[model samples]
Target: MKILPEISRTLSEYLLIPGLTTEDCTPDTVDLGTALVRHRIGEESGVRIATPLVSAIMQAVSSPELAVALAQVGGLAFIHQNQPVEEQAADVRAVKRHKAGFRTIEVTVGPDTPLGEVARQLSATEQGVAVVTRSGDTEGAFLGIISLDDFHLERHGAHESAGSRMRGRAGLVTAPVTASLSEANELIWEHHLDVLPVLDGDRVASLVLKRDYQAHKTYHRASVDGEKRLRVGAGINSRDFKDRVPALVEAGADVLCLDSSDGYSVYQAKTLEFVRETYGDAVSVGAGNVVDGRAFRYLADAGAAFVKVGIGGGAICTTRAQKGIGRGQASALLDVVEARDAYARETGVHVPLCCDGGLLNDSHMAMALAMGADFIMLGRYFARLDESPSPKVQIDGQWYKEYWGEGSQRAQNAARYGQGGRMVFEEGVDGFVPYAGSLYDNVERTRAKLTSTMISCGSTNLRDFHRDAVLVPVSAESFKQTGAEVQLRRPTADH
Candidate 1:
């Protein structure tokens, strides 16, 4: 049995101190933005990740759809390495190919296709721009694109079916695929076309929508690569990263992270070097799950783009119980952060650090960031969300989602590693979390909580929270008094 840390000291021992009181400061003014551990998201870009979940796990943990969604909101999802490299690469492709931007080819309707079929196709794809083409291809020819405005007008005015209206390219404005973004934007602006389909000899190439083009041009918050696809990250274990990193980079992973639970080793270091040497400055590599100042320094010396902290901190983790190893999360994060500062001062390379696991609520997350994590990596918290690979299950009238840690034997099997399963000694557990809605909803709510907490603490931005925020120990009773401690009712049934 292990002695409780509270026997020596409790979490109530340290409390965060706030910033200077200001009436003008509001949560809206606060920006929780950060960068990929390499300090940049792209080739010469200042686009910062607003709230990232860096390297949570490989494909067994995160899905491509979730990755794309996170990137759209200015954060990244690490495509997990549990799947075959090609499948993982395909997920990356799907994320990079998602359209929250300029589209050259979208939904297409044939000139002779029935209006009912056209309506169904548009509804299914949620396609705003419907290009009318001969031979049923929105891809074929410089045929006229349908204007929703004119379609609606004709629908209400002349009572024309889609087939009749789409019979010719007369009313549509077309552009050659060779046109530059500026030229395309100009064409759309000049003609007031809502959707312009680029044509390759009458075949549709790319659908360029005006609003998306404007957002791509104006929104600084959107993280995009040189090709304009959102930036993304991938996780690879030290044992196999040398083989995986090359394929991952070619498949458009903007950053690479060593997903080892413990990374202070010669093998991990050598692989880190290989990635650094091969990719050069093209990709940033993150590594670790180090629990102390010494390990943090070691990783910094070995060129980790960012380091991970916490060992027995994850919700389902059993490392401490089984091996009698690991430190309390709070102590580990604070000490490692101090080491990060010292290393930065000595080497002039400020390697960003992420706090992995041990988070149970928004308040814990808030305190963690206040304690100096560049970002928080969540497992079970994310697992319960709608986007995770877990399927929702109904149990006793409550909804739940499956959650498993990478060290769990179930996770090994889930990854289809047969002999790998024999080696895993169950350092982690397979379990379930209460079904939370979508990741987007959960993250927004979490952001709101952070904003409220930061505002109450009198801090304006993340930097202020890091620099001016202070923690003062509180008594156990005092900690309870500070929160929702009053027990009024007992009956509960999913909120």
Candidate 2:
């Protein structure tokens, strides 16, 4: 028995816990928006967006229903992939859509177009972004990009054309006469420039103007992705019930995302009721990919915990082009806001609302939050990764991943609809998707980018992003100047 002296702190000494200095122990006061958004779904989840920021769901890559899974973690998904209308509708029925701030409206533009011309186009349409392409073909490689404000000076005849201005400049000013999105914003306000152009390589590829960008940038939000008790979700096609939903729940799915192209169908309504009755509130229900709030109301009446709002707003989605049946994201967001508020007031349940699409970047997310959404869903952004069903492979000596519709004929037939006309869903039923790898990296990187945007507005959290921000349209030159031609600085997470 080695007798070691027993050492113990006295009661009084024990009172002094390490790391407990309390000259002022009170916590700093946080606003409602920040307070509500400070929680996470599970311990492993990262910081919440405070505003719902989600990616779009296009079958060309990922399904809209898959977007709901991301939303459970405080993101949005757009379901406008190139699937058939019925199949697309079925995908929308697969997840819960919550109304919250945060959006990103993805758009595209050609590479050959002059920056000045692109700026004018954006100005005329009041569109915020333009995804620049190197070729005239849709599948063409990416080229340099631009924002509307990049062309502000050039459009205003600051030095005739951008070429002339750059040529006229002497010394260090010889570089492209454009700014990144952040710098362009500063220039737009400080110099009161209109449009900002995003440059790619040396030429202007796209543009973002003060007014148009701001139009979707401004809004207010209380909280995003901060639900406490039950997870509200829904299923799209009956076939997903056994397969996808069970797996999602086992992985921490609380809400059921019931989505569809049209929310007014009997099939959707019955599906909503069936989910509510079958799940018996074990999971809170959410439904719809409806543009206006009508579908939201229907789903709510059918025991939906949340409603998804959106018609057609997604990158890689040809819905608008294919069907020409959809509402603009801005208008749809407002409509859902009205419906959600009114419904909440009418019913004591206070079910949340979710914006389903029309988001391109951090600013769009802020705008959606300001418009009063509880959550946002994402799709295309989250795809192209390992977790996605697609398989990644080297094609044509380039990194490429397979993307397809979950409700396509191939999918529907494979699902094996029974004699009762209902599809059977079970685990392992998730269709084939290419391996993109490390969604954590993609999501985290995007989050960092969004945080930088928030910081630019002097906001520490997504809450402040909504409260303290301004949006304004711009002229063509300004748009061009704010484009990729200028270096868009990536922000550090700590920033």
Candidate 3:
């Protein structure tokens, strides 16, 4: 057997050499916008993201809530397919139904409902507010609103009906459906109102909360479709593409991705063919988890909108140890990127590359983009956020969120592993990640760091970063020297 001479390398083994800092190259000027699909050379991609990041297709990371949050922050999340088709489609619909500055009246109660039940419903909502509608339907006749501040369970007996405590519509300040978001916000702050229900005739159409307006102000670069709904993606396995594709499309999924541990196979090819034949160019589907240029070329030629580059490199993945069939993440990305450029030169089709998994920090993300990735896919990063579907638990007085791989025993997603109808063994581990606060805060910080790096590299956009950025190999000792040398101070008791 012949062996390659070059050694496999990881992103940590290299460091970016800073370039000239031009006067115009600043973080504000650095544009992270990137293509999410294949397009002809010199033509803009049909699907593009304002940010070059995406959440992974795992049960613990991507959910309807997470999808909406990420889309609002200018990124995208692929809803996992570990469950039934109907459930996944419903999750897609939930994301599609999301309105940026408006809150759907999910927690609603009738006027006669007990305060105890209203409390339960309000507690389940993030806003701690509930609408008191005539028939308890979200769009039922307008009545009033009840919040935690309106009454306390101890002061106002739990047995009291919501009608007894709620502020009636006649006294409440309401906005017409034609009111703009800014106008609603103005009314909310002017009247010291917690929520301004937008009424369509006598029915409560939707509620605009103070916090939602503030969130919109913070994340104004939200990714949306032509209809102004949040953009969301869904993952599909090769085995169920025939049945799953139509349902996801009908449910308003903006894009589809073929999720597999090893996507360079006949199964993925057949799935791509079926999607292309049935939906034409209307459905943008990506495929991957490849480790070489050959695999990249194969998928690109087979009509993959974008190809994911990485294998056995996820935080929870054990494919390399269990099966010994994977390459180094950095090396894998380098090879695929080379092929991608060549393919573009030959056919004039510029298929984007998604650097999936193995990224540990903002530095790694910058290195991935510098090495020629159009976007990055993150599992552990997003899994730690409040938006993730996983529940958080306290361990040793430290909060952690549950994070598991699609191939883990907890997930039992056999279709992702392509191991018959059942999983013979686990190829991933169930674990926990430190709880990071909200998606907006973390994503903003990440964007700042990445943009700062681009500025240092003298690049104002991703295309310039790809062309002008330079990286050099670093020794193990040099890598260690990059961290702090002195002993770190211990945190105070108060801190």
Candidate 4:
């Protein structure tokens, strides 16, 4: 039997002390509004994310709960496209239900609703503005929005008649409504206006306003999924690209994840180029899934905000095995590291790297961040939650949970991954993955473990964690100790 160290033993006896502790770790509570302005993404961006964490947009994973929870924590979530557009819209609505420390909500008012009445209602409700709806949702019609500030801009308070200011263009802010929040913020700053309207295919559906929109857009914050921070964004798909692009810009997504698998595909490349040509460098867009730096050079040169890294690291993914394509994750990250540095010097554009997969546990997560990934995308880690679509089931007597990949045939064919992945039969699965009560518990636990790991590594904050961590290859003995703590714990029973 191996001898255990005494409780009195000093840490230096076994591990090196960067002299770090939980106290040294910084809490990720930076105000998103301030970060945006600091980052220059937008000052009048309606949606603001405080943290850089973004939920993966895979249908089997992201949900309304995911959106709301991540938003609450100051990160943003991309509602996956696998679900019906209506469902995706509902998820977006759910995010608004809980404030992400922002000032506005993207609510719709009937087109027939009189402008004067709309202004009065906004004054009464104190919501500041409304995205005027012309037809059904997702139509991309821009009409106008009634802003109380704009209403007050042209007139005095209650003493001055609301009618004078409510008449004609004074009460309405029109639009192709297609400006990015950064553009809108600049317009608002330059023109001194309060509200900008967004048009759907047939009507105005939303308004971004000065008081309600985040003042600055470029600040990055720690993400909800991992250490990489996220700004605001809507994950878009092929079908809604044109219509939703403006909406995403208005919603305050700083970086767009382009939402494609093959970054090298002509369609994806063109889409990236189109966004750049149309918006210029007003917003940052990320494209992905090309294993080499060749694709990175093109996207970065095309003004991609960031580049996605990884091919088959998702839990349910079999891309490498199925497609016979993909470089190993560690190898890929190393390549991107070189690419990011070289590209930054040559182009003067610093594109942060997000390692998209191959992270299996906390150690792997630490390794990814340390190995130069600006952030890591976790699928299985976020799966198997109460918010996920899969309901609990009983299999063999042992309890287990469900997880999957976005590329799995079962997921795509059945559309099961959008709400939840395909449920595998595991005995006592319910008992195994009991609700675990609240997700907050899980988040807290994960954070604590991550923090402790950082302490062990002699680092504080994600930046330091990556910059200073020491990576020694693990030995057989260390691997065997994986379940030592669990093995030591025994259930107590009554006679």
lDDT of each: 0.71, 0.47, 0.90, 0.52
Kindly list the per-residue Cα lDDT of model 1 for residues 167-224, writing each as its tens digit.
2566667678677777878899899977776667757777778777756654445556
Model 4 lDDT per residue over 1-495, tens place? 653242221111122234444544544421212111112221332223333245676665577666555544445566666655455555554444332122233444555555466566666655665654344133534444434654543345444433333323335544444555566566666767665554444555345566634422322232322212123345665445666666666554444666655576666667776777788767656677655677877777665666778776655566566556566676677677787767756755456666676766555665666666665555555665566554555567644445545554444523221224343321111112333334445555655565566666656555566567655544457656754655455667952
How close to the true structure is residue 254 of candidate 3, measured as C-alpha lDDT? 91
Best by lDDT: 3
Error of 3 at 316 (Å): 1.8
List RMSD in Å for every model shown: 6.0, 24.4, 3.5, 12.3
Give the Cα error of residue 55 in candidate 3, in Å. Answer: 1.8
Model 4 misses residue 293 by how many Å? Answer: 2.9
Per-model tally of clashing residue pairs = 21, 141, 0, 47
Error of 3 at 4 (Å): 4.4
Instruction: Kindly give the stretch of ten consecutive residues in candidate 2 with the minimal lDDT sum.
Output: 9-18
The superposed Cα distance between candidate 4 and the true structure at residue 461, in angstroms, equals 2.8
RMSD of 4: 12.3
Cα lDDT tens digits, model 2, 345-397, are 67644555566656665456555655566566665445666555555678666
Overall local distance difference test of candidate 1: 0.71
Candidate 4: C-alpha lDDT: 0.52
User: Which of the two, 2 or 3, has more lDDT?
Assistant: 3
Model 2, runs deviating above 4 Å: 1-234, 238-253, 278-280, 407-437, 456-470, 473-478, 484-495
Q: Best-fitting candidate, measured by TM-score?
A: 3
Question: Which residue segments of model 1 deviate by more than 4 Å?
Answer: 1-13, 39-47, 52-55, 58-60, 104-172, 175-194, 198-205, 209-221, 413-421, 482-495
Candidate scoring better on lDDT of 1 and 3: 3
